[model samples]
Target: MRKYSIIFIFIAFVCHFVTGQNKQLLYDFSEIPQSLLINPGTETDFQWYSGVPILSGISLQAGSSGISVNDLFANDGIDFNDKVRDRLINGMSPKDDLSGTYQIELINIGYRGAETDNFYSFGIYNEGDAIGYWFKDYAKLGFEGNADNLNNRFNLSHLKTRGEILNVFHFGVTKEIDNKLTFGVRGKLYSGIIDFTSTKNKGYFVTTEGQNNLLSNTLSADLELKSSGIITLDHVIDGDSSAGDMIKRGFFGGDLGLGVDLGFTYHLNEQTLITGSLLDLGFLYHSTDVLSYTLKGNATVEGVEIILPDAINDPNTDFWQDLVDDVEGLVPFEENRKSYITFRPTKLYGSLRYNFGETVQSKGRLDCDCNLSGGKSNRTKYANGVGGQLYVINRPRGPQAALSAFYQRRFGNIMAVKTTYTIDKYSFSNVGLGLNLQAGPINMYFMADNLLAYRNIAASNYASFQLGINIISWGKN
Candidate 1:
C-alpha cells in the first residue's frame, strides 16, 4: 500500500466517490412550468408558453454526505489497506463534502408581456457542477509517512476546489406590482464549457530532527491549478484535435460569463404567501484554452542527497535524473497559460405559503363571455396549498442548508400535485414528488427526489429527477 499510499487512497476514495439546491419538487410547484425556474415571482395565468425544444427540460442531482460506496469498498473482507488506514486515522474531516448538480433544457419559451400584468421568459441551458472536500492533512500525510509525523504540521490549507461545465443564455421578467407585490428578474449569458479550480492553498508539511537522515523534511507550498476548456496533455498524446474540434471549441469557443437572477412574491394576507430567490449571481472568465499550475517553493530534506548507480555501464550515471534534478532545485514547478476567474455556485431560495381549500376563481370571461361591456379577470387559484422551504448554497465547506415541507393540490384546471418533506445535509428520508398535467394547452411535468431511496438505491445518500414539456395559453380575462 505504497505508491504515495496509492495516491492517498485515491484521494480519500475520490472524496467519498465524488458525487441540490434542494429544489424540493421544483419549489412552489405552481403547476410546473419548471415552476418558473424556481419562483420567477411565480403566479402565471399563462397567456403563452412553450418548451419542448430539447424535450423541454431535464435535471439530475446526486449527493454525498459523510461517506458511502457501500461505506467504503464494501467487500466485507475488511483490511482494504486497513480500511484506508483506519479511514485516514479515524474517519475523515475538514468538513467532509462532495456535491453535485446537472441540468439541461435546450430552449424554453414564454410570453404574455405587452403589459397584461407582464411576463416573459427565454432560455437555453446546460449545466454541471461539483464540490469537494476531505483533505484532512492530505489524508494524514498520505497515511502516515512524514517519517512518523516528526513535528506534526501537515496542512496545505485543506485544499479547496471548484468545478463546472456550462452554457446558459437567459432572459426573464415578471411584474405585477399592485395587488400584493410580485417581481422577478433574470439575465445571464455564460458559456464556459469546462473548468477546474483550486483556491487558496498555503504552506505546510513538516518533519524535523535530522543529521544523516534520522528525519528532516519540509516543503512549504502555495499551490494552484486552474483550467478551462481542457484538452492538452500535449493534445492528448498527439492525436492533434478531433472530437468534433473539441466539440466546436467547447460549445462555441469557451470562456465567457455574466449572470443574475432575483425574485420575489409577496402578499401577507389574502391567504398568506411570501417568497424569495437569488441564484447564480455569476462570473466565469477563464480566458479560452487556459491552463495553470503552480507550486510555490520552499524545501528541505535529509536523505537522498544523490548517490547511487552500482554496476551498470553508467552512461553518465543518471541516478533517477540526479534525483529529479535535485528536486527541481528545491521545489519549483510552474506552468501557465494564465487568465482565470470563476464564481457562480450561488443559490438561496425561500418560501412560505398558505392558501387553503376553496377559492378557485378563474372562469374568467366575467359576465357571460363578455364582448360588449363589463370585463375583469385575474383571480384564480386554490385547490389547496401548504408550504415551507428554505435552501441555501455556496460552499467550500460553508453555508449549506435545506428544509422543506409541502403539499399542494389542484385538480380543476387539469391536474396538479406536489408533495415534499425534506431535511438537508443528505436525507431524513427526503420524500418529494410532483406532477402536473394540463390537456388543452398542453404542459407536462414530473419530479422525484429521494423517494425513500426508491426502496434501497444501494442505501441512497440522495437522488433527484425532473422533467418537463409545455405549450400553454390562457386569457379571456
Candidate 2:
C-alpha cells in the first residue's frame, strides 16, 4: 500500500512539473508618460517666478496653495498605488497570494533665472530631486490529509508587498528668441533603486494501512484495495514534507534629455491676452545594475525518496555563479542594463484670457479667467490617454480674499483640476489661476491623478504629482 502511495505522489509531482508554465511576463509600461499635449498654464506665486519645471501645473494649483502637506502626500500616495496596480497584478505568480503596498516620497529644490529683452530670452538653472516607491507580497500554499487515499484537501496562500525608490538631479539652461519665437534646452541626471522578492510553499499527505482493511471487509473491497496500493504506494514510504522557493533582485539607472518650449502671448485687447507653448521634446537614458538570485527547496515523497544534489540544495549559490564559471566568459560580471527613456510627445498648451478692472484702488482689482489643456503619449506596446481642466480665480488688489473654483478630467494616469469663483459687484475679467509657487529662485508644487488603486484596468481616478525648481533669465524690467 505504501509503495502504491509513493508512486501516486511521484506521478502528481511529475504532472505538476510538466503542466506548470511560467507566468506571463506582464510588462506594464503605464508609468511611461503620455505624449506632451497642450496643457493649461497654471502657476503658483513661488513656481511662476521661481523658474522651475512642473510635471502638471493646473492640478497642483487646484489643491489650494498651503493646504495640509499631509493631504498632499496622502493624495499622491493613493494615486501611485492606483497607477501601479494595473502592472503589478499581471506580473504576480499564479501560485502566489500577494498583498503588499508601497508609496513614493519626493523632495525638490533649485534655482532659475531668465533674461528677456523684447526679442530674445535665455535662462539657466539647476535642480535636485528625489522620489521613492515601496511594496511587499507574501505567497504560500498548504495541503492536509493522507497522501495515499487523499482523505482531505486544503490550501492557503498570501502575498504582501513594500516599496521602491528613485532619485534625480538636473542642471541646465533654456533660451527663447523674441516673445513670439522661443527655444530652450536642459540636461538631467537620474539615479534610483529597485528591490523585489517572491516566495512560495506547498504541502500534502497520503495513506497506506486503510487499504488492507478494506480488501478483507468485502468482495468489492479487494478491487478498491488494488487501486489503493497504486495510490498509497509512495506516501506510505516517504511521509509528509514541505518545499518552497524565492528570488530577489535589485538595480539602479540614470538618464539625460534636452527639450524646447515655444510659446506666444498676444494681446487681444487692452484687457485680454492669449498664450500657448509646445513643451518637452527630449530623450533620456537609464543604466541598471545587474541582478542575481539564489534558489533552494525541500520536499517529502510517499513511495520513493527523491533527494536533490548537495549543489542544488545550497541557497548561497549566486545567480551569476554559473556565468562567472563559464570557460570563455568574455563578460566577467554583468555590469548593467541600458534603456532609452523617451519623453511622451503630448505636452502642448494653449489658453485665452480677458483681464478687466486693473488695480486702481488700495485693494487690488479683481480678475477672472478660464483655461483648458490636454495631451497623450503612445509607446511600443500601449497607448496612454489624455485629460483637460478648466478654472477661474478672484483676488483682491491686496492679499485679502483670494478665492477660486476648478474642474478637471483625469483619464488613465492623467489628472486635471478646474476652478471658478465670484467676488465684489464688478465681476472680474478673464483670470485663469493655474500657477505654481516660487521661493527666491526655487519653485515647488505637488500633484496627483487616478486617486483610487485599480489594477489591470484604466480608470479616470489614476493620479500623479511633481514638485520641481529651476533657474531662468527673467525679462529685463
- Which 10-residue span in candidate 2 carries the lowest summed lDDT? 19-28
lDDT of 2 by residue, 253-366 (tens): 222344444334443443344545444344333233322222222222122222358557875665455433431142132222333243312233444444333221110001
Report the alpha-carbon TM-score of model 2 versus the true structure: 0.29
- lDDT values of the candidates? 0.73, 0.25
Worst 10 residues of 1 by lDDT: 364-373
What is candidate 1's lDDT per residue for 171-215, written digit by digit as tens? 888777765777888888888866777867888989888766678
Clashes within 3 Å, all models in order = 0, 115
Among these predictions, the greatest TM-score belongs to 1
Using Cα atoms with residue i matched to residue i, what is each candidate's TM-score against the true structure?
Answer: 0.38, 0.29
lDDT of 2 at 79: 72
